[model samples]
Target: MKFNRQKREEIITSKKKETWGQEIKRNWQLYLMLALPFIYIVVFKYYPMVGAQIAFRKYVPAFGIWGSKWVGLYQFERMFSHPIFWKALKNTITLSTYTLLLSIPIPIVLAICFEYARGKFFRKSVQMSAFLPHFLSTVILVSLINLLFDNRTGVFIHIIQNIFGAKVNVLGDAKFFRHLYVWSGIWQGAGWSSILYISALSGVDTQIHEAAIIDGANKWRRIWHIDLPSIRPTIAIMTIMSMGSILSVGFDKTYMMQNPINYDYSEVLATLEFSMGTAGSVPDYSFAAAIGLAVSVVSFVMVMITNKISKTLSDNSLW
Candidate 1:
């Protein structure tokens, strides 16, 4: 009986190995193409996971990552006690929430408009104009923003001042920072973001539209009943993904747009990490790492929660 079982196991193992060999042999070129990306993820993404250990250590430059003394959660304790960390965390969440709330619907609306528009030429023109700004680098975008809102030279500032005989510094005012950041990002990314929805809309069954038309459904009714239902899954998925990053605001744009006057409202976690780790006289590498780790943990938890909620409510989730 033992010999019979062993023989059966051997046959199964041999078959599995043979199947793997056949797969590799048949798709050797495809495996070769995958090699670079595999190496890239190993080198760039997974490898850096080892360095995350610094968050739990006293990361002295002399001691190095591995050689650094283990400090448990000392850095995290310091971060929790730091006023700037809380401020930065608060600002980061606030900005991200505002951007998410304000920017999420614009792309959907624009994509729907594009799908429903009668004039192909006008749609293309509008799409090109909306997409053009996304290509601008963060530096150039910030510079353009400054030029457009500068207290003295900004066209909008000039017009407002001329019309109302009042001075306004939109960039300098902390009250306006969130609005500027969110709206500028909307302007830059709305068209690009809508492309996915547009593609989804295009794939909608033409037969459904034809049936709706035959049933005396107007364009608005078709959009309401047919178009939106078709893209509801996409919308739910996009929104779930967005909710996952409720703490991550891009550093470059925030940093470039940030000034002393707006720091109270604009100093997000990413910029704070940059400032804490590199900008000071004595860099607090461990503390910065702890903050980064905290942010990552929070983001992961949020993603999980968002995915769970989405799955429960809509049966659509990243997982």
Candidate 2:
């Protein structure tokens, strides 16, 4: 029995090696195809991690990354104490929250509405129009927004003033910046975002809908009882992911939208990091790195917390 067991173990080890060798030999081209992406990730994503230590060091160009003196958490301590840092943190959270409220639900609602639309041509046209904005470059989108909301010459303001006889500077006001940013983003992304939920909706059983209809269910009833429940898992997953990034408002559009007047409301972590890292005569790379690391840590913690809550409340989570 011992001799047979030892022989079986040897045979299993040899077979495992043989199977691995055969797999490599047979799928050489497929492995080669994967190599490009592997190399790209290693170079662009993983390699940069080595530089993250700059957050702890007083990075100087003359001394290089390795030669820089370590300051431990001095940069983070300074960041936490700075008033502008707090302002940036607050604006980031507020804008992201506004964005979450405005942007996430509209897509789901639009997708459901589209599912109920009877006119194929109208639905297709509306979908096309909604999707076209998503393809627009950031520069063009910001430019178009500026043109539409220009206090002195905008067509929208012109119509409003001519009709009501009151001039309003929507673009210049800090209060209106978040509204414009969030709503415009919703308009651009709603249709594209709806594609996923619509796909989920399509998978819902038509037989269930037929049964509900036979039982005297109305359109709203079917939507409420059938459609919404069918897509609740998708909504939960999307919500969790969005909550995870509650602080990472994009820099390009926000930066472009920012002016001296709206800086207080529009300033966020990304823009603040850019300002700290390179905007002044003397760049503080360590300080910027500390802020960036803080944002990442906070985002990660949010994901973990949200995932835990989602699992406890609804039994749905990314993990």
List candidate 2 stretches off by more than 4 Å: 1-23
Across 64-87, the per-residue lDDT of candidate 2 in tens digits comes to: 888999989988899999889999
lDDT of 1 by residue, 1-319 (tens): 9999999999889777677778788789999999999999999988777788899999888888999999999999999899898899899989898889876888899999998878989989988998898898999888988899998889999898989899788877889988889888988888899998999999999999999999999999998999999998899889888886788899999999998899899899999888889976779898888888888888889888888988999898886
Pairs with steric clashes in candidate 1: none
Return the clash pairs for model 2, or none. none
Note the clash tally of each candidate: 0, 0
TM-score of 1: 0.90
Query: Which run of 10 residues does model 1 get worst, by summed lDDT?
Result: 14-23
CA deviation > 4 Å runs, candidate 1: 1-30
TM agreement with the true structure for every prediction: 0.90, 0.90
Worst 10 residues of 2 by lDDT: 14-23
Cα deviation at 63, candidate 1, in Å, is 1.4
